[model samples]
Target: MFLDNLSAFLTHPVTGTVLLMVGIIGIALELLFFSSGLLALAGVAGFGLYFLGFYLAGFASFGDLAVLGLGLVLLILELVVPSFGILSVLGAICLFGGVLMASSDPKEAAFMLVIALLVAIVVVIAAIRTFKHRGIWNRFILKEQLTMSKGFTSSPDRSNLVGLTGEAITPLRPAGTALIQGERVDVVTHGSFISVNKAIIVVEVEGVRVVVKAADDQPNH
Candidate 1:
């Protein structure tokens, strides 16, 4: 008699629909928004109530509850740990299986599963777009912008070194170190190899690049 009453209450059309909606919405919200676990708790509670109702109605069994619990645990772990999407896939599969098993009618179960999946996808896409530009999302997504306004300079200005004379300290197969005014400076030769200890003159300085040529070589115009 007790079981019959419980089944009657749970199988009520309005109550069953409401419970399912609450569970779906709660889980979606929890996944999309970064709350202090309040949304997660609500989601868990909603799912718990949903399963309890189904069990009371004889539409679900203890095995169904176990499967659902496993799915929930896997999903939670996917969020907390980085499994490269492995956990997520497994969790989704478990959830689908559990939900299917919990429904007495195959058609109803299939319909509900489709609706739930579509809703989850839409919510996830929307959330990603909305939060993609935020700073908090940067930690998970790699984004970098280098601008002069941000004080990011790719190369230093070496124009001052122009016209300075230096002696090649190392062979410049177009690039090597030189001694300019007793200070070691990095420099590049002008299309020709310069031997060590040879006198060279800086003919051009572009950004951080110091271009030099043999002192006796005719300078290019």
Candidate 2:
């Protein structure tokens, strides 16, 4: 009797609509805000209640429930494991299929799915603009800028070596090491291979890259 009464209430259009909205909103907020799983739990609960109500009302078959459960698992996996949106796409298809199968009215299910998608998109965009720098995204993204002021350099500056002459320590197939000012420095030639022990001049220095040419070769400048 209690189950029947609960089903009678849940099967009402208003109750189903409310439950569906709550589930979708909760899940979206969980993904966007990373609310320490509170919103996710609430969303799970909402979905659980919805499925139970529908099952009791004879609106959902075992297969429908299984499909919905699989979809929910895939969606959760998408959050835990990044598959570059593959899991999300599959989960969406399964979720929609399950909803359609469970609903007596396909039109109503489709309408609700559309609303859910719109809400999710809006929430994701807003969250990205507001909280992107702080939350889960930060874990997988590089947010630091490497500038001279920050003492971050990709390589040591070789500008001081310009106009200096050095002997090639290794054959330069356009790239080799040279002893300049008694310090071994890496250098590249202008599309020409230089033999080992060959005398070379530092023709240019761009950041960490030292450009060299044969000592007998005239400097471009």
Candidate 3:
């Protein structure tokens, strides 16, 4: 009787939805926190169980499983290589299509899938915002790259100091710091040595490399 009850639950609509939600949350957690940790395994297992339940209930076909496998591959590729979210989107579509194929009732499957996704999104948001400060988050997620991935960035545009003039803060033996516009900036000379506190002028600017030369009273060549 216990075995029968377990089987019934496994085949239940709610169980399938819960499994899908777990799959989504697990994978998301793995990516956000684990990097290459056990959360990813949990996600894979969740998806596996979800499909397995449908198969045991005689609802999922081999073709459906194949599609799900393709989706998984796409998602993995999305992580390993940056495709600007294109691979991720395609993977999601494939997974959804697989779910539809595996369901005996397409409309009911879609409804459950939609509900699971909405709840997963809410759960993920809460985890990221409300519980982000909790110790558990830092333990799971790689915080080292968090700042660089989505935070304040250093300005790389040094084109403003192109025409500005300044003094050499350090001896520019082809590469040194100079005081440009009264501000000490890192500058480089074109194969010419610049002395300290020398009257230098900006000759050219190539991106962040501030090219400079001694301000000699001669033809402005």
For each candidate in turn, the TM-score is: 0.70, 0.71, 0.59
Off by over 4 Å in 3: 1-7, 130-221
Instruction: Give each model's whole-structure lDDT.
Output: 0.74, 0.79, 0.78
When summed lDDT is taken over every stretch of 10 residues in candidate 2, the lowest stretch is 11-20
- Candidate 2, residue 75: Cα displacement in angstroms equals 1.1
Candidate 3: minimum summed lDDT over ten consecutive residues — where? 131-140
- List, residue by residue over 1-221, the lDDT tens digit for candidate 2: 99999987876666666666666767766765678778878877766777777789788999998898887787788778878778877876876687778877778867766776676667667867887776666777779988989998888877889899999999999999999989999899989988999999998998888999989876479
- Candidate 3 has which clashing residue pairs, if any? 33-141
In terms of lDDT, model 1 sits at: 0.74
**Candidate with the greatest lDDT versus the true structure:** 2
Error of 2 at 160 (Å): 1.9
Candidate 3 lDDT over 1-221, as tens digits, reads 66456546765789988988887887776555545747667767878887777787778889999998888788777667757678878988888898888888889889888998999899888877865665334755777654436764455667777767788888989899987766778888889898898888888877678898888736657
Better model by TM-score: candidate 2 vs candidate 3: 2
